[model samples]
Target: MNWIYLIMILLATVAGGMIPMLVRNLRPNLPIYMLAFTGAFLFGVTILHLLPEVYHELGHEAGIYVVLGFFVQVALQGLSHGMEHGHTHLPAAEGHHHHVAVFPLLFGLSLHAFMEGIPLGFNYSDASALPSLMLGVMAHKVPEALTLITVMMHAHQPKAKLWRILIIFACVTPVSAILAAQLGQHFELVTKSLAYMVALVVGAFLHISTTIFYESGTKHHELSRKKVVAITFGLLLAFLTLIFE
Candidate 1:
């Protein structure tokens, strides 16, 4: 709820979306590797830190929310086309371009971001977990931003419209966090709500991370060395974060 924390989250969100646009000249594969790293890091943090916290706080009942969150993410991907996990497949819009119906994708991604913001704001006082959760969310946002921008470009969306959507998406997280924080101040059951929300977010993270890992490699174990290194580094960083926590 602190202004500095909110500002940090906002800056991180904007940077994630803008950095990919700024680095257009870089090797395409670099972002892909980064996606792998972020995915692995998210997975590690969820499994190592968030899951334990949620179960410890809420008991076995929390598992139900986790399961629900897993399926909710699966459904969201139907609209987002797995963009959250770095999948950016889009049909070609070469000669005869048409405006793509990007609203569904935007809505899906925004909802996901909003859900993420709730736990972030609600748990801002948890000194041990807050930093890791924020970092994991920020890391996940980068490749997601890259994937989203790429999809819009492929669909021949106007630059102005694309920027509008990106800006809105960037704002959604902090706004949700602020709103959740305000609600928590007024609600008696805020702690219970936050616990459930955290469990849900953990489930969503599990689905996304597993999907990224499953899709990163080719048949016959043909994963790239760079991707392997990225994943390993991501895991190591997450472990260190856990230790600090």
Candidate 2:
């Protein structure tokens, strides 16, 4: 296993989590646009690279795991209130202390993070797909980390406690990557296991990317010109990366 993937992912996770702290005064709409771009890029990568790779590696049986992963993500998003897609709805006033249950939210997000790590760790040698997959995962992590921090702040968690929680959340992916590497070593048919895991993560990506695009519009669900441009740019980037990869 190449240790560099672990380091890169860990750094991306930590940087993403810390973004909210650094950009507390950023315009809210900016992050939404960023999320839209990331979502589009991820969606493009899934359709272009991941889906084909999984089907090629594992045959048609991999579709079942993809469907299962999609529903699993649906269930997780329910618990997380759609945080994965930048839906961090909070009360207007920070002074109003609502009893926000943290455990369920953390559990859902952590599970999602762990699942994401498996494919990257297990398939690190695939030069054609790994770059795009890594980029998609890293891009998605930023908005997710930002949303998670926003929610925790809204819940009035202490700064120290919030940092601790964020660190743990950030670590989950790398830890899971290491675990997946270990599991791969144990499996006699490691390629099949990796293919199935990639399919599962691809399903989760499909759910998330679609949700982000669907929600990224006006009340009437009309996309703005700027948003269209951003989405186009994202897709183009993904295509170019795939071509060059």
Candidate 3:
């Protein structure tokens, strides 16, 4: 077994997941600019990296999953706001709150995070794909970690509780990667099944990326004119990086 992959992933799990928590704890209320920055990072990864990679590898079936992913998140977000969505709810100055996402909501949330890497993790044919996928996971996970931290801090929850939430979030990716790495090997002999799982995860990413945009918008006044400009620029850059990457 390549213990390096295992070690690198575990290191990333702890490193990537903890940075934002430390930031949030140090400053309980993050500025909107900071949140927007996180959103921009998300746009860069999802649009620039994750989505294009999925489509290139899986094509139209991946497209369908992307759309499905969007709808699923919309529905999930509708159910509630705050840590439940894995993001901090903006204060009264930013948005509203709901209690729909309780303990039971975790399964869907965890599954969403788990399936994030299923496409590139298990379904890719090229060896070069692995490194970029792993980097993208690390880079993008920063915002996800930030999101959960923001959610917990905004709720003014205790540090111990917040750490617990992050620890749980920490496992979703590494565990998924490990499982995908093992399971993906089997599917190499079964391309169709691989394609189907790829489609499912592509859908998940599509949903996730779009949801980030929606949450960024409505949760913080529905994409102000300034933000629209940021998003436009972000999307253009996203496409350009896709070409290069």
Candidate 4:
């Protein structure tokens, strides 16, 4: 648990996140493609990395609450139902666009991101599990960061304001890592808490993956055989990654 490795992990997260922004200049279709790839990557991480780790740490009885993770996410989405759809008035503001109310969505994402740092903190090279957790967080952060960006942009917040929000979102991973590191002696409690957080993350990823695939403006009616193969291959790859990992 050398402190330097934690710094390295944090740096890697920053690098992983920035890759998308570098390709930010690409065509609209390219981002969509990247989004699809990122989605597949997240599905891989959630199913492969998070779920397995948690299941191993906490058996069936405690794990039943895992499905509660899905319900929790659905509840979040349901509460903010208007934002996902189209424009609707915020309850507090009464006439503003619904995205104004999207801070809760951002809050959920941030909380999840903060929870992710825990594993990265405790996960030293000695533990076989750390890498997958790190990779999943890294893979998922791209879209999460971009979503944070677009959500802020859609809200018409200033560039500075958006950056501030992104900065706060970015800091959570490292903060969680530090927190885990500080409490290293209490591994059991850490494992239990992380297990629940991972379950929550799996739910969040499941929702995002399905939403991106089905709800994207792309038309399935005209989806060609090749596209179908690509998406199927993409999903299959994700499942296999989970199984093997």
**lDDT winner among the candidates?**
2
Clashing pairs in 3: 65-203, 66-203, 69-207, 70-207, 88-150, 88-151, 217-222
Give me candidate 4's TM-score against the actual structure: 0.68
lDDT of 4 by residue, 67-174 (tens): 776666566555443222111224443356434655676665665566557566644322544655565556556545655565555566776676576667677887
* Candidate 2 structure quality by residue, lDDT tens digits, 1-245: 66776677767777877777777687867867888899999999888888888887778998998998898899888677778887643335546775677888888889899888887766643476877877888888877888888788878898898899888988888788777778778876764577788788889999988888868534555677877887888899889876745
| lDDT to native, each model | 0.77, 0.79, 0.54, 0.55
Candidates 1 and 4: which is better by lDDT? 1
**145 Cα displacement, candidate 2 (Å):** 0.4
Tens-digit lDDT track of model 3 for 79-165 = 334322245443363354533333434455566567655544554444434454454455455555655555555556677977787
**Ten residues in sequence with the least summed lDDT for candidate 1:** 214-223
lDDT of 1 at 89: 41
| Runs off by more than 4 Å, candidate 4 | 1-26, 78-99, 118-128, 184-188, 216-245
Where does candidate 4 clash, by residue pair?
Answer: none
Ranking by TM-score: 2, 1, 4, 3
Every model's TM-score? 0.89, 0.90, 0.65, 0.68
Q: Candidate 3 or 4, higher lDDT?
A: 4
Query: Cα-based RMSD of the predictions, in order?
Result: 2.5, 2.3, 5.2, 5.4
Per-residue lDDT for 123 in model 2? Answer: 61
